[model samples]
Target: MVRHMDERAGVDPRRTDELWLRESERYASTHPRCLQLRERARAHMPHGVPMSWMASYFAHPPVWIDEGHGAHFTCADGIRFLDTNVGDKSTFCGIDPEPVVRAVQRRVAAGSQFMLPTRDALVVAEELARRWKLPSWQFTLSASQANTEAIRLARHATGRRKVLTFTGNYGGHGDEMLTAFAGEGRLSYLGLTPAADRDIDVIGFNDVGALERVLAAGDHACVFTEPALTNEGVVLPEPGFHDALRELTRASGTILLLDETHTLICAPGGLAEKWRLEPDAVVVGKAVGGGLPLGAYGMTAELCEAFERGESLTGRPGELATGGTLFANALSMAAARAALTEVLTPDAYKHASALGAELADRLEAVVAEAGLPWKVQRLGPRSGISFGGRLARNAAEADADEQPELNALLRLCLANRGVWEAISTAGPALSVAATRADVAAYVAAFREFVTDVTGTG
Candidate 1:
């Protein structure tokens, strides 16, 4: 059973709330420029920001980014921060990587889009196929689209309409994946209109028995999930979990589709390659375009053949509704090509892996010394800090470890102290451009926050 937030995690909720209020006031007073901009921009943009999530990023006004380079960025108020956010794991190779920038610059001059295939696109597809060991590839503007298309392909191939996804696993913003299981197995949606009411089902993460039972019904077209649930704070797969999953899926003739959008930071070829877990279809986004918007999905030879048969039977060449006009724009292809070839090389992964281990060790030590229950879980160069001693096995336990007010307090503290953790729910991502100084800054801020809030120094 998952422990409640008030249980085990040694946090004084009242004190933390008080500190959050005090910090919010301090942030508002100090960043007057940001405050003024937020007030003025509210007339134009929703909640004074373009994205809805920006409104909930802070108790006070969100800090507008002035500019970013390498492992750090400056806010609108001229306060520079050591960025552990790394564009919410999108800029995993670091910002403005020279090769990607140069490639995009050249491609932009030649042509942005032409509704025709480019040499760079072919090269990128080949590289992705080489990395993931898949035979065919398709591109989309975002991971959500990639996931949506992958689902469509799975259903078309299997003649099954239902998709089984683990609870708390996020695969973009597709309507089919937007549904979540409320407590007691009740289903709910993030929006008013349900994206998938009858076609999508929720299962337990790492529960091979549950997976086997569901797939045994022979009703699900695909099992869509991340190798590990990163969205809910890094719920790892249990031992022998993948072995059972593969056996069950194969036996039941269900396609296993792994979403590696955020997990791309986990390894050079992402977690699928690192762990030697083979899936019929794979989806990747975020860092694929070297900080630009691009997502790709790779299909095994069998799935590719199935897709081709579906396309032929449909009687339309490009009207499958799987892609948009600018799905594979030349600029995005060029950037992805440079990113896969020049930036995210083996050397880069080696360096980031070492750095991530060190960051996890240091953060864990700090928490231990403070006598806190928090545990730091690292996935390659990225890590998440959970308010529990043991790592979560599923989304329910992962959600139980979350303390929203405490999360806000820590994020505000890190921001105020010159450290930026972009995805506040997860952990920090150490980019290739990140230096020792950046790591030190992050450690220092975490130490200060832990000691201050827990009074353990």
Candidate 2:
């Protein structure tokens, strides 16, 4: 017998897989153009896309997009969608915001890049310092680069060989930050030498006692983390968690490195401002560039001084992990300056926060009314829906509560009705351009899906 969608506990694995396959087949059948493109492109690319993860994101081939603008994009097959995923928060200000577009256009006409430096770079750096309350800043081409460089800086300043990171929290694709705590104190790593793996210490998020105990060893150089957990699920920090994190790291002389790529949705100044977190170093990317690729790492006064003083942990000069040739390129600097000063302003955040709350509240109401075992949560302009009723306290709980089959079914349902969300997490990020109607449309589609799946309409 088929089970109700809301029946999650002790769910039949085979049934879930079957349901996902059904939806996947349906998606492929409807989009013949997508299928044709997929076959044709496979001759050159491994999975008919530039990236392999794109193919793995959906059970079916990824949808091809023709054009995108504020809050929406048209698929290659001509289907338009309310894009809540917002390029995984890479376009949180909205696709092609006029300010960013004009900045790029104007700068490109003047010049795109110059290894020496550009005036826009200084302006962007100053703006970031003002927003984040940090004194020194450096630019990179991506968040991964920023994070990797931050770790190197932390090690150089502290003269330590090991790094501490929470399980299920992703810092970036850097080899050192690519490890996860696989529950029960077991750690797993990817594409790193055993020596590099050992330098990474994995622990559970929100476990203050565990964090303190680990740092007490005095071998860790830094604790890299997102202010609030995301991707695996939106597990928020428990009360007093940030305070404890700050206290432990400071006492142990471990640099606190925060990756705000996703948690930038927490507020105008990101989670650091919202929660009043004072990390030694901070990394930001994604929407910071307003669609252009850019990343930045900011440092406190002491950390900056340490780097300049050549205070390497091992008595060796620190390598230049800070930037690349195109890091502070003219075009990216102009785009970032425009995004920070004009597009992602206080007014835009106000709109985004309200819409985020509206989407979360409406979805939660639907679940509550239907008496389903589901919950919705919002962090400023970001929101997520999870399977269990109560919020997850940590990554382990969040992982256990995930409903992949439900996620696939809902994704397909929403896509069919003109909504698009992040496939990895099914999280929605409200853009500055998102309207009340967009939120309403998504909520209505979700309500319809819940009623249909649960047979409670």
Candidate 3:
């Protein structure tokens, strides 16, 4: 039986395919410059992009962006697009935020990096501690690195060899956190050995029973999770889920590590602060540096003390568990200082959250007017339309709710009409620089797409 039968029946797949064909033709005709660039790029780079994933992630050919200002960007074709994706939330503060730009400029002129720490590192760490309520902090080049280091620290502090994660959770690209549960066994991704799976366990989100069962083993180092499942389309935790998770992990002597990298969109302090979560450690990245490459992990003072007493992997005494040559570089620290103090302020979050709510409401109304069995799921300044009428409770249901053909058609339609939505797996999000006008533009394009797909016009 099809789980999303109502959604499937509302819009005929045959009509969707036909409209997709039309949009594909329109995209090809209108984006000649992007096409030419792709051809030229293919001669030097694989799949016409520096990153292989970028080559086929979009419904239409990837548009070459010339520049971005506040809430919009111009493509190589001289067309401006309302940037709802915001670099997949990497530029959540908005493109070229003045304070960050000025800070970066000064840092570059002075010096970009040194193995030594700078005053900005102290300032950034202080700000992060203040916001997250964690005393000790460390930096890395990306959230993936932060997560990796956090896992190692957890292992060191607890003398455990295993890790725990929830289903549909993305805790960076690290090998240890990348596997998911398959039946009674684990499913490791390519390039990962079965050895990595031996120490990892995956369970469904919001399943307190499963979490308790796994943590009871008493050999797990940490339970890594987001405040909510953002990458799998904003699957929020049920009421009291976090409370149970914390209680269970605490009782079992397992560390609770929350990755707030994407969930930073939830608020200035991310969901940890917004929800008053008391995680032992928190990981953050992406927009925290105003789009510069910066990631940080903060630990409670107790955990910090434990980590200090712990030995390094090489059996060195009194050495910290993690450090990188370029970690805490001057440039990243400068940008983070500016971003936290000036760009991602309370007022900016207020504006972005308002715009996010407005976009979700408008899209929901559009679906209702079109009489489609779809709904918009929102998290803070982020929102995405799920094809199913009800929200998904777990990863399996979320995966089942996916309508690839419909998603691709919607993305291509929005792209052709000058709104750049997020990639297929993610959703549109408002940046701090977004305005009502941008939200309206996105709604207009989305409404048109609905009309075309459902023949509701």
Candidate 4:
């Protein structure tokens, strides 16, 4: 059963409320410039921010970043922060990485887009193929678009309209991918048509029995999943989970699509490569373009050949729905190529991994010292503290373990101390450019927060 905040041991609601109040005041005092900018922005944008999600995701008024260099960024208030959030993994290669910046500058001077593929496109595609082991590749502006296209292709290829996705799976915000399980039925998020849940099935992340039962019908075109659930929290797959997943999908003739946009932090080639899991196709994005917008999907040779021939598994010819005018534009292609080749190299991953391990260790130590019932979970260079005694095995447990008030207070405290982390839904991620100093700074700030909250100083 899920435990409420007040029901959890070692956490006092009144103390949490008091700390939240203190942190909120501290945040307001230190962020006057951000407040001023937000007030000005409110005249045009909702909640005084360009994006609706950004408006309420932060603990205080949204910080206006003047510039970012490597693992740090200066807010409008002139305070520099160790940016563990890394633009929510969009800038995982680090802010303004030199290689990507140089490549983007050159590409911009040459013309950003031409509705034509540049030589960099070939280089980027070839690199993606080499990393993910897929022979044919395509590009999109975001992972959401890539997932949408992948689903469409899967439906076309298999002549099946049903899509299977695990609970807490966040590939993208595409319509069909947005539905979640609600009791015996499923419900689509707001703004989505009722038909969004038409043929989509939602199951638990590591439930082999549920998986077997669902795929038994052989009606699903594809089973889209992440190697490990990251968005809800880092829910690692149980032993034999991946094996069962791959085997079931194959026997059922369902297209197995692995979305590694976030899991790429797991290794140079992402979890798909790290675990040697076989999939019909792979989708990646986020850090792929450094700080630019880019998404890519790769397919096996057989899938590509069948797609090119416009033939489904049953040899039915159909009109293909893919490609966009601005897709694979020159600027994005150049950024992706430089990011993969020059910025996010093997050495870079090694550096981030070392710091990530240290950060996780320090966080665990702090939690233990505080006598809190929290557990720290790590996935390569990413680590998150779950407000539970043990690691979550599925999305439901992760959701049950969430402590929103505590998290908000923690984030506000960290921001006031010159450390920035991702939103409540995300954990801290060390970028390729992060240094040991950055990790140390984060640990120090976190320790202070824990001491204040637990009164253990």
Candidate 5:
């Protein structure tokens, strides 16, 4: 667990609280259009948004987005947001990148789906193999689907029923994965699943002891994790954390599954390649489809051979090496192909990384100069600033000291300052577009919000 160095260094906690509260009130007062959208949306949307997670923010009602272009979003009120959230990091190359759009348009005149795999799927699979160093690939509709499918395949290959994961990670809404640990202990979310059997085990990301204990059990099919658990406020890995993890999983005879849904912002081949960490399977979705719904799991040659030379005697109807009809629909394949071949280049990433780094550095400078108790964490092109000290590790780190009320206010303060992003924008695998002016505006917004909240020059 990473202790809050800021807290250990004796930063004042109450100062953080007061500043965030001030920011929140200022935010609510300025966004009447968002409030109106929330009201209209509530009549139809179960939680005032299509997805319940959208409503989890401190804003009682969330801002409604109208449309997006290269790197900007216009809200219902026509105010342009810097587009940091980018539909939850699904817009990796920035929204509707021209090549991807053209690809989609050209494919749309032909068809949307055929229930038969498309030729673009072949191209995508080949490019994925070339880039990710995996010989085989399969597609699904979402990251959750890909993650669960990878788990099932790993279990089927090993003849193990149990799955293992880090304590605070989200790998889609898979039944075995929708569990979280808290003040009491592990429990199911939305009562979706019962603890029929503890088939899944949770360990802290950087905790070697906890990981060793879980892996040594020898019954788990795989250890699934993000390179860093950026989902819960960008908990970066310790030095050599992933290398040790790779070694341990190999020694323990368990497969390592890396979920790159959020880390695509880090590298073209995702965080796995950036760190030179090898895993048995990699599930990457989000940006692969270029703002469309697409998911894929890439695996090594032996895994491909396992499917090819499987136990015919033990084969079941819905066994491993399985997929659905619409797995690689034409439109999704077209976008995926364009995104990989054209948009996701090293140059694109270098441009984004520079802007993101500048924004993060500016945010840290502003907060530190103000003597605020908050801290910022960044990975690749994404970054998030927390109102409390540095988060430790996973959910436990979140629980111990974070004041959500403060974070809520901070997000509002930011929105009020014309910076529209998810509160966890920095950590949620998002990036501002490469344009320096947009990046500068985002920095200006944060600085203004901080100055407003702290009531200092």
Candidate 6:
């Protein structure tokens, strides 16, 4: 007799290779195109895609998209979806908008990259200053580079070797950022060298006392943070928590680096402008490039001067661990310029922010009616649904439960029913490109799925 896994909160442990294989068999029967493409990808591309993160799309291989426009992408089989996983938030305006597409088309005709600098980069830097109120800026190809560069700037200027971050934080895969806390200590993710272990420190988020103790004892260069913990799965800062953190970092002379790669989905200005956050350095990547690969960091004039004066940690500057050869290529720059200027406007935020709340309400109502033990959390437009009622404030809380069966069921159900989701996020948050009705469609699908799966009569 097959044991029925009791539905609980968090990620369920019912998922194994056998279960996944069974699901894959079923998925392939319907999505023949996807199966064929996945097999093709496996033949050449490791896991069928260049990016491993993309490969980690729950169980089945993610469907390959043919093209995207407005709020959705058309998959290889010509299925148009409400694309919540907009290039994993890289497609800020959803798929491809006309303005961004036109800009790329026009710029492509003119030229792509020239290796020197373009007028767009200058405009982008000025836009950074104007919107973020920071004085200087740098560019790169991905958020990882932006973050690594920020740390380099911090350590160089301060001559401090150590960096600090909260537990359950996701600041990109720079070497220093791999440290996660175990009890009171930090542990490096495997294969990282000894130097990474020595230089990075960890503290618990929203725990002021631990932070104070760490800061007080530290000779640290910078404190890297997400305004709210996002990667360990969408945790938010407690009220006044950020204010206190800012004060503590200032007191300790530790440069505060805010990584806004995911949080930018909330609005045009991101969390810094939205919450009036003040950081010595700000790193933003992903969506800013209008789906192109782009990463950027901004700082004040003083820090820029320190960098210029050779006070930076780079006493011997070689190939920057912070970037690649095509760091600020013109194609990416032109695309970013268009996105920053035209796509991420105030009106878009109003739509997405409002839709985010509505989606949560709908989900909550459906869950309550179904008696499913689940909870959803949202910050502006960035939202997530987990397996419990109490919202997770830390990584531990977020990890307290993992409903594997539910997540898989939900993903397959939604995809089969004509809605697409990340399985990690709440409602893919609303995009400027989304119609009010388009955002609601996911909520409706969820309600229907819960009723159907839970056998709620």
lDDT of 2 by residue, 381-445 (tens): 87878876668887777776766667767777777778887766648788998999988999898
lDDT of 3 by residue, 1-457 (tens): 1222334437887788788789999999998999999999999999898876575667577988899999899989998999888877889999989999999999999998989989999999999999999999999999999999998888888878888888888887766667543313333357766576688888889999999888888989899989998877889999999999999999999999999999987788889989999999999999998989999999999778777774744465776558888888999999999999999999999899999999899988988888888879989899998886678888887877888778888899999899998988788999999899999999999999988988877
Task: Give the clash count for each candidate.
Answer: 1, 1, 0, 0, 3, 13
Q: On a 0 to 1 TM-score scale, where does candidate 3 land against the true structure?
A: 0.95
Ranking by TM-score: 4, 3, 1, 2, 6, 5
Each candidate's TM vs. the true structure? 0.94, 0.94, 0.95, 0.96, 0.90, 0.91
Task: Score candidate 2 by TM-score against the native.
Answer: 0.94
Alpha-carbon RMSD, candidate 6: 3.3
**Span of 10 residues, lowest total lDDT, candidate 2:** 1-10
Q: What global local distance difference test value does model 3 have?
A: 0.86
Q: State which candidate, 1 or 3, has the greater TM-score.
A: 3
* lDDT of candidates 1 onward, in order: 0.83, 0.81, 0.86, 0.86, 0.74, 0.75
Candidate number with the higher lDDT (2 or 5): 2
Which segments of model 6 are wrong by more than 4 Å?
Answer: 1-7, 10-26, 181-190, 312-323, 423-427
> Model 5, range 2-119, lDDT digits (tens) per residue?
2233443233346655665565565557667877878888899887788887887544357777888888777777777766776677887778688899999999999989988788
> In candidate 1, what are the lDDT values of residues 263-329, reduced to their tens digit?
8787888889899999999999999899988999999998888777735333534324488899999
Task: Identify the candidate with maximal TM-score.
Answer: 4
lDDT for 123 in candidate 1 is: 95
lDDT comparing candidate 4 with the true structure = 0.86
Residue 303 of model 2, lDDT score: 86
Error of 3 at 68 (Å): 0.7
Model 1 C-alpha RMSD vs. true structure (Å) is 2.9
Is candidate 2 or 3 superior in TM-score? Answer: 3
